[model samples]
Target: MVQIPQEILDQAKELRAQLHAAPELSGQERETEGLLKDFLKKRTTLELVEEDGWFYGVHREGDQLPNVALRADMDAISGENGPYHGCGHDGHSAILAGAALACEGKTLGKNLFFLFQPAEETGKGAMQCREMLKKEKIQAIYGLHNLPGFPLGTVMIRAGTFACASVGITLLFQGAQSHAAYPENGRNPAFAICRLVGELSSILSPENYQGLVLATVVHLLVGEKAFGVSAGEGELSLTLRAHRSEDLALLKEKICQQAEALAQADGLTLTISYQDEFPDTTNPPQLCQRFEAALKKSGIPVSQLQEPMRWSEDFGWYLKETEGLFFGLGAGEDCPGLHTPEYEFRDELLAKGIQSLLTAVFL
Candidate 1:
């Protein structure tokens, strides 16, 4: 196993703490980007590349194309205090930085690129980085996330779909308002809302689709709370997930169709909007094997997951462009859950995370 120098690990820990203190949400990652750029410039000798909100550092002796790329997300999730690094992206960025620093002045047979991405929580960053992949001629890519429920530094991954595809859908129902005393005088969508909710629940069964699919009603807003008036406007928001992108698309279409039919039957106008779209992250078999082999060679404990996680990751977009592997490094068996207010990234895993990334790059 290659050990990360103590100074490098300490620097990474300090960087992670600085990032956690001031987090940015989704596409708003300007401060985080600046900090990362400054770190790379001061610590690594490799030339850095910047495009949009994303950036990368390349290490090569000649004109050889990069054989593999390593990526880390730089944005944080929303928190009660403000934007927070509750998802451990701050650690991810620092780890990638450590990897870049480790590769400096080393003569690896293949070229390497370290990518720092933005807006992963909102599922838009990877798609935007697609252009970078093409320009860099990267053959394969690798990424990692910190998992909370496993032993610290344990590597968790699988060969097939690692994470599900998901999207957020919003349905707006508009109808005529009427006085509460004469509710019958105007069209009300309260009935339609109830019917749609029930129908949406019915769609959650796996038997209705080829694989796992789920629809969660995240938010609902009914008509105004005025005591004298019956509300005619209502909004329903749902997050839909499926193991395959095709299945997700079909599921989305079915939900929209059912919603439209219900709105028509109730004499209401329906409008739909989608957000936070994520594609299914499918790992190529050979790349996954290489990742597992690398982890085994490093003497890290490896956990092979039997099923794809229900949560969505924007890194799924990268798989669509090139073969890749996305794995998880366990933070701790009893660590707080991701995106929760109490969640803090495990500083002890910094050296191991950096080494795991370096192993994958050199594998």
Candidate 2:
């Protein structure tokens, strides 16, 4: 294993603390972006490319060498009051920067690209970063997420799907309004909305799908609060997830069909919209073997996961375009779950995360 100086590790911890204290939301990380770029500029000898909304640092070895990419997300999740760093993205970005610091004066066989991405919480960041894959001719990519329920310093690996695909579906129901005294004169969609909600369980039944599939009702809005007028419109929001991309597509189709039938019967116009769409994050078996081999060569502890995580990751977008592996770095067995009020990234994992990145590129 490459030895990183304790002073460099301390610098990384300081950066993580600063990031955690002042968190920014997705697509609005101007200050956060500047902070990261400044760190890279002052501390490293990498060539920095500042894009319109994001940035990356490149370690040039040779034009003929293969290009390897490493990515870390740079945004926070929403909390009760405002933007919060509940997802440990602050640590993620800092760890990647630490790796850049370790590689300041070394020449690995491949050209290394350190990608600091924004808007990952909304599943839009990777969509923007995918262009870099083609532009850099990135042959392979590697990244890691910190897992809370595992032993610290241990690396988690999965051969197939590592994270599920998910999408947000919004259903708008429009109908004619009527006075409370003569409700029969206008169309009402309360019954249709209720029925659609009721059928959610059946639509995602286990027997209908080869792997895990789920539909969660995140929001429901009826009509006006006034009692004098009958409701004219309503909206329903659902988050759908599946282990396979094909199943996610089918789930959307099934739910929309059901909503359309219900709306037609109630004489209401139904409109469907989507947001926060993410694809399944799959690791090719060969790449998984390579990751495991890299860690083993460095004497790092490693383990395989039995099932795919239910949460979605935008890193899936990059894998769709090139070969990549999205592994997990264990935080601790008793660590707080991600995106929770009590969660904070452990500073000690900085070294391990940086070591893993160095290993992948040097291999």
Best by TM-score: 2
Q: Provide the overall lDDT of each model, using Cα atoms, as 2-decimal numbers.
A: 0.88, 0.91
lDDT by residue (tens digit), candidate 2, 222-297: 8888899888889999999999999999999999999999999999999999999999999999878988998998
| 10 residues in a row with least lDDT, candidate 1 | 59-68
Off by over 4 Å in 2: none
Off by over 4 Å in 1: none
Give the number of the best model, judged by lDDT. Answer: 2
State the number of backbone clashes in model 1: 0
Q: What is the lDDT of residue 272 in candidate 2?
A: 95
Residues 1-363, model 1: lDDT tens digits: 888899888899899988887799989898999998999899888788888877888887667645679999999998888888999999999999988888888888888888999999989899888778888788888899998987888888888888999999999999999999999998888889889899876766677787899898899998877989988899999999999998899899999999999999989999999999999988887878887888788887788877888899988898999878898888888999998899989998888888888877765
